[model samples]
Target: MDGRLIYLMGPSGSGKDSLIQAAREPLQALGCEVVRRVITRSAESVGEDAEGVSPAEFELRREEGGFSLSWRANGLAYGIPVEIDQWLRKGRHVLVNGSRGHLPVALERYPELVPVLLTVKDEVLRERLLRRGRESPEEIEARIRRNGLFVGDGSIGDRLIHRLDNSDDLAVTVNNLLSLLKLSVKPDQI
Candidate 1:
């Protein structure tokens, strides 16, 4: 990342969603745009983006140039709305929680993406999955394995990275992100 993308990444159950929501104000006040993705999964499930669409609808939108980029993860399809590129082209910092496996390709679009690798202890992740109460114990374990915690191929993540251990403390993690982005700790925004 060249230093402008503000890419948020981590394994499943790593508090990525919460951290992204928490960073909204600081990001916007700093002139950063948050990308709303289109997901194939049901909005009711965990890890589904709030702005979700049916698989068929997502395909239609994609065919009509609604997405800047799209990828599949664990059988689910995800699309980054085309608006994100427009905002980034305007030189606005864009904060996005993208597909972990697609980080390198995403970075190629913008030379200035600041990649942040959010991490947590394995046990903490397991506990969080349990607390969410959507997955059985076996499913949680499988998710942990699927997430492949902290195991990068050393190609993408080895580059410029701001690693945050988000184990049990979200406030600190968000604060650190704000500091890293040179954004105000508190922001007055909608």
Candidate 2:
């Protein structure tokens, strides 16, 4: 059996983090590993910021063969650890928070990769962004502008891909994803 790789990519305020957090436990209970990604930015307030490492450190790690896949997005670097390969080797699917730009490369090399594009109404996204209070209104606007980028827009990666909506309750969004991915779920009954 071939394993699968699930990627959740979206706009900044589309609730990707919230959806990931809500689904983490239930997904794990189903014998799945939601692969945590490493980033080059300070974790600060993004609850699931993974772990932070400097760009230099990330480069060194990359040279040492520490990452299965690493790429930059919005001026920040992110990577999936090589250990995840072990899970895939055994036909165990792994879910990850990933850059949408990686979709094309992933599709080419790892046929198992499944990209899940997330979207929300702009107003809803703006409200969530404001509530987070992590960015100034200007920054929020910039992010939203950046978020809508896609294939025809000369964006970094292919925009034609599987997608999921996150406009409903956070938990519902997660379950909807699980359903779409055909991933197993443990009975937390959420």
Best by lDDT: 1
lDDT of 1 by residue, 40-99 (tens): 877768464467678899999999999877888877788888887767666677788876
lDDT of 2 by residue, 30-146 (tens): 556787778897766446848788999999999999998889876888888998888877767788888776777767767656677888877788898999898899999987787
Could you list the CA RMSD of all candidates, in the order they appear? 4.2, 4.5
Relative to the true structure, candidate 1 has a C-alpha RMSD (angstroms) of: 4.2
TM-score of each: 0.84, 0.84
Which residues of candidate 1, in runs, are more than 4 Å off? 1-3, 47-49, 146-158, 183-190
Please give the lDDT score at residue 101 for candidate 1.
75
Point out the worst 10-residue segment of candidate 2 by lDDT: 181-190
In order, the Cα lDDT scores of the candidates are 0.75, 0.75
Worst 10 residues of 1 by lDDT: 181-190
